[model samples]
Target: MTSEPAQHPFLKMANVNVALGDRNVLHDINLTIQTGEHVAILGANGCGKSTLIRTMTCELYPAIPGLDQPRPEVSLFGHSRWDLTELRKHFGVVSDSHPGLYSTSRAPDTAGSSTGRTTGLNAVIAGFFSASTLWPNLIVTDEMRQRATEALERIHASHLINHLVGEMSAGEKRRILIARALAHRPQQLLLDEPSNALDLAAQRDLRESLRGLIADGVGLILVTHHLNDIPPEIERVILMQKGRIVADGPREQLLTAPVLSDLLGTEVRIGEQDGWLHSW
Candidate 1:
């Protein structure tokens, strides 16, 4: 019956469990995410990454049976996260096909060449309503608009404010979506595969941008399948396999060849130099 995401230390999960179609997809999960710390969630595809994402946002299931008795109850700021409205104050979500966040937005009175254009700036504006996209009579005000625009500017997407939804490049769209998430200035950033499909330069840019946010003390939860995608800023990683946690600890302790190889069920070697982690 709490509301906030445990403002005390950070985000914590105690004996969390999740399922899909009567088959448990996640089991007995315990994790902690503190403010200003960037944590990565790494696993093979369908290893419960998305399920964990939905759980953090309180969008997973209404009544995760057995929650009261070690169920997948989500809490933030030392309170239950059932209150969708208050729950968002500390979390921002980004995923592929997040609707208007992608191209093909149906905004009227638009100009030509709307293809691949991202009006994601508007989605940043929609953060006040906790919506993935803008809607009719959505109750926005002048101050809110200013804040949203400022957030876009922070991510250097102010110029794309009026760009058609389908006109921007992949990287541009991604930045806009991040801007939208940051527009609310949530305490924690819940990112899902942030580096997927991004080229080297774009990936570098993303890395550079994250430095500032991490320095600012924002808690970050990132997910990716590649070990290289885990940023240097990430202090901890929780490896998942078959919907269960395999290893969890400091980046150095858990991201090594032995740990990673064990979790991955293969003989893998890990190397790190200058904060970049790679596996072979």
Candidate 2:
């Protein structure tokens, strides 16, 4: 009898060793994220959460396990080899620095600063070329514009299309970033510290926007240190400590008071209310 085809996980890193300047940052890491899954990577600062996200997004490569051990593999959609740009088409990434890319006001003396306002539509259109702002040399077609508009519409930000990026609120700007990333119609979205520098109201709006994306069938991988940053849709939780994965399981299994306390290295009380988690 013939055997079935091998299953391909959406994102997989097995026996991964990542180092920076001879100092090992991640050790023997093995993580697998399946299609359509919502997962949150939780940890304090310098716990390797950002490194893990960067590795998953292909911004960093895994190191050889050791001289005696065979080289490990990092796969996206089951393939280890990829043209970076072409591979980016498969998924979109949103990092904390994304908002800065929308900045319009800058001192003339600031090095590498370009001063210009970007409308919501233009912001989304720039994603087609992976540029932070629409530049003179970038070529844009009617279809690309339409796709950008549709992406904004999908995220309920079409109304802000004419608004300049500098004028929008933090929450609105974040939605525009989402629209920009979605313009490519990628299968998955990677978010790093998505709720950073947002007020309570903006955080609520951001969470709602995330729900909209999930409803549209976009898989999400969220990396954040805040408990409330995790939306209700995320089912799995991965905890990191000192550059290693300490726990990986369903949210319910990992978000308990004791576990969270240990993960954060503090004695705290955790409470759940209205599908949101808060700790003190």
What is the per-residue lDDT of model 1 for residues 41-130, given as tens digits with 9 covering 90 to 100? 988888888887777666565236553574554556666634565555566666663433321233432334333332666666776775
Error of 1 at 139 (Å): 3.7
**Number of backbone collisions per candidate:** 21, 0
What TM-score quantifies how close candidate 1 is to the native fold? 0.83
lDDT of each structure?
0.70, 0.78
**Which candidate gets the maximum TM-score versus the true structure?**
2
Candidate 1 differs from the real structure by a C-alpha RMSD in angstroms, to one decimal, of: 3.9
Supply the global lDDT for candidate 2.
Answer: 0.78
Off by over 4 Å in 1: 1-6, 62-72, 97-120, 130-136
> TM-score of every model?
0.83, 0.89
Model 1 gets an lDDT of 0.70
- Expressed as tens digits, the lDDT of each residue in 1-280 for candidate 2 is 1221124577888889888888989988888898667889999899998778778767688875657886788888878766656655667777754333322223331223431377789878887776667899999999999999998888778898888776677788778777777887877888888888788988887888888888878889899988988888888999999999989999999988899888888986888888988878
* Model 2 misplaced stretches (Cα beyond 4 Å): 1-7, 97-115
